[model samples]
Target: MDYVFGFIGAGNMATAIIKGLVGNSVVEPDKICVCDVDMDKAQHLSTEIGIEVVSEAEKLAEMCHIIVLAVKPQNYAEVLEQIKGTMTEEKVIVSIAAGISINYVREQLGMKCPVVRVMPNTPLLLGKGATAICPSENVSTRDFGIVKSMFSLNGTAEVVEEKHMNSIISVNGSSPAYIYMFAKAVVEYAKSQGIDENTALKLFCATLEGSAAMLMESGDDPDTLIGKVCSKGGTTIEAVNKLNENNFCETIKEAMDACTKRAEELGK
Candidate 1:
């Protein structure tokens, strides 16, 4: 708890991270501080989560040893500019902003402080997230380990290359939405077929969980697994055929491409 943690945004992601840090006993409530443009939000986190609320971003930057830039990508420049004077090489800057690079953050702050770029998904709120972490060359091994350990409280956190950070967004950062959309479509079709909505949803979710486990545990690749379930001309193969006919894989590749493109644009 000696390392004071300050968050610049009180949004859901920030709240989730703060909750993980405090709830898991990684940091005491008193060691954490937060400030948001919306006073109500800052107050809510302070009142409900038992953390201190600062009046300005600059003040938070000045107070904490580990500063997390939890604001949006577009807001990064402004926040960095405001806290530039407070930032020192000793302080660690952790950015969860998508599409924002460690170099961009260092340049914006006009300092060569340790910068850790993280791509985290909404599942962090449920303590079942996947996060990709990359750090600048100046980041110490100790600081990087702290960040990786903290993220492990939520879910799996992996170290990736900075060159792959943008591509990583499509894989984990925005994939939850794609899964939800796919689930929604399936649920809608079940309802249209007069099946109970809740039952279909429950079964589908369980199937998703089992499928994920199989993908991880089974030695076979996706195509091999598909062949296993898809007994020649069976119902599973029929559905698979239809999806293939409709360019399902191609469509997904295109979607991922679009996501990467947007991330690149945001970084620029």
Candidate 2:
């Protein structure tokens, strides 16, 4: 819990995590280090978040006991290669890259390093993240506890089997984009019907938050909740019937299937 943390990519997701850690006092700014391909990005994070900035991934890895691989999936190989030698058995590599498996990272690092795979949604910026942590066998109980606590600074975190890690990519990691798309469409439709854009935005967003809160607190399943809202011949049922006619549920399933398949491919 007192260990230094380093982020390899000082981008948006990395920034979110940094802010969560520092904002929640999970770790001190000085104890957190960041490095990026761009020195400007690293320096910006250093200035904005008060974290230390290193010029190289290897340097960051050496200085910090916990390393966050926040880089893109395409760049994982290069970054891992650079820091492989510094990945001591005690160090924990928490990778945020979707579809990057723990076994794949260990092979890339050429050691049975302690690697934790996490799929966190962007809402982590608001400290309301839904993060799933999948740890390799090399990771100890303390490692799991530390990672979970650190992630909890931003939001809820759950541990799942590595076999379900890729599926989690679609569940919460990529689900934000799907929700955004639906929100955008609904807001635009409301605008087309003469509702003010700002009002529509606020209304829909709050509805989203409230709906999720109800789902979490109500102790009832989604179908039961939906039934409560849908009267025999009500407007809700009309819309639901339309959605069914258009195969909305089937479409969502198809999308998730594609997402999981692509995730499997990426792991390969």
TM-scores of all predicted structures: 0.98, 0.95
Q: Which stretches of candidate 2 lie over 4 Å from their true place?
A: 1-3
lDDT scores for all predictions?
Answer: 0.91, 0.88
lDDT of 2 by residue, 1-268 (tens): 3338988998888898888878878778988888888999899889887888888888888888889999988888999899987778788999898889988888998888889999998989888899998888878898678778777888999988888988888899999999999999999999999999999999999999999988999998999999988999889999999999999999998899899999888777
Per-residue error (Å), model 2, residue 57: 1.2
Model 1 TM-score (2 dp): 0.98
Clashes of 2: 0
Among these predicted structures, which one has the highest TM-score?
1
lDDT of 1 at 261: 95
Per-residue CA lDDT of candidate 1, range 156-194, in tens?
Answer: 899999999999999999999899999999999999999
